[model samples]
Target: MDDVTRFLAEQQYVELTTFRRSGAGVPTPVWVAPDGDDLLVVTVDGTGKTKRLAHTDRVELRPCSVRGEVAPEAPRYAGRARVERDAASVARVKRAIGAKYGWWYRALTVVEPVLERLPGRRPRAAVVITDVVPLDS
Candidate 1:
């Protein structure tokens, strides 16, 4: 595994910073798991992070609090992110997340089917972060 991927995979929460069209970075806390050398993040299909990705793949990532707060000393990494909406990819990410997060994730999985019945619930997509490297300090 790449150092960046291994490091972030061990973290409980990750602050995924996606870039706006204007180049501003929007950071969101997300559950992530390691998929080989890449980092996998699952999110709603139409979320801002996914929308932003349509315009740019450039992103920064850092270990952070569950609420998205990055500590002063956290290491940051830069990478290319791609949102995958295919069933296989989505399923793979969900499995990875469920394995890492355990019971809480299992509970979510149980509830997910019911939630999907909602009138307009967005489908989940998997965001794969690749080519990651530590940002220069």
Candidate 2:
């Protein structure tokens, strides 16, 4: 595995910063899994990050706490992200995330169907980030 993949795989959460139209950084904590040399993150289809990603593929990732606090010594990784809306692709990403996250992931899968039925609760989708480059800290 490359340095970026290896470094990220050890962390439980990543601060995924997507850009707004005005070039503002909006960072959110997300669960991530290694997909070959790339990274996969699952998020609600209607989230701001998802919408932002549609207009821009640029993204930055770094190790962070579960609440989105950036680690002081973590290196930033730059990459291009694309949404995966296909069922098969999303399922594949979900499996990888579930395997990495274990019981918590499994529990979420159990509740997701019910959660999706609520008003304004859109289905979840996966974002695949590739061509990751570690930026100098």
Candidate 3:
């Protein structure tokens, strides 16, 4: 496996940093799964990172703690991200995530729909990131 895929496979959470119009980086912790040569992340559709990615595909990924804390010595990978809205693509990503995360993934599937029905809850979407390049390269 390539470095990016290997790193992601060993990590439970990754810090996905998306750029804002002002060139600021917003980092969020997300569950990630290997998808062929790419990585997939499922997140709320209308989140800032999702909106920012729409304008700019440039993104950075690094193994991180569940709370978004980055390990100082971890390598960072760069890639272009695209949101996936189609049902088939979304289902594919969902299955990948579920397989990787197991019970936690199952629990989320059970709880997310109820959470979405609550006031102020946002719908979820999947993002596929391609052309990942290690920053050291």
Candidate 4:
């Protein structure tokens, strides 16, 4: 988690690719924040991603070019992810976001609740972690 934590803290955005039920894949643009040793994202339940995450706890998060552009051939970094339910953990994640992105965090605080109440918005917390199994190099 150390390397991941550092990578995420420095990267502003990541392309989150999740598995779809139809044996396909879904790629989404997400604004991520650090959550201790994991990356945190707040999304509503019952969405396509929510369901997919429920079925499989794996996802790929790739750090894009700092210029805010990505090529079609970018290779994503892979990891396993899961839903986090603890209140303390949630608060920690929120604080991390606030610390990293100041003004944006303040702005989100105002709209977060409204977004949470939107239809199909479940406000679930996701934590992506690297697999412990070593890769052959």
Per-model root-mean-square deviation over C-alphas: 0.9, 1.4, 1.8, 3.7
Tens-digit per-residue lDDT, 1-137, candidate 2:
68888788778999999999999989999999988887899887878999999999999999999988886877898999999888987898898899999999998688787887898888778999888888875
Q: Which one is best on TM-score?
A: 1
lDDT of 2 at 19: 97
The residue-by-residue lDDT of candidate 3 on 10-85, one tens digit each, is: 7989999999999999999999998777788888788898899989999988989999998788899888999987
- Choose the strongest candidate by lDDT: 1
- Cα-based lDDT at residue 117, candidate 3: 88
**What is the TM-score of candidate 1?**
0.96
Candidate 2 vs 3: which has more lDDT? 2
Clashes by residue pair, model 4: 44-121, 44-122, 44-123, 45-122
**Which has the higher lDDT value, candidate number 2 or candidate number 4?**
2
Model 2 stretches astray by more than 4 angstroms: none
Poorest 10 consecutive residues by lDDT, candidate 4: 128-137
* Candidate 1 vs 3: which has more TM-score: 1
Candidate with better lDDT, 1 vs 3: 1
The 0-to-1 C-alpha lDDT of every candidate, in the order given, reads: 0.93, 0.88, 0.86, 0.65
Each candidate structure's TM-score, on Cα atoms with residue i matched to residue i, is 0.96, 0.92, 0.90, 0.72
Which pairs clash in model 2? Answer: none
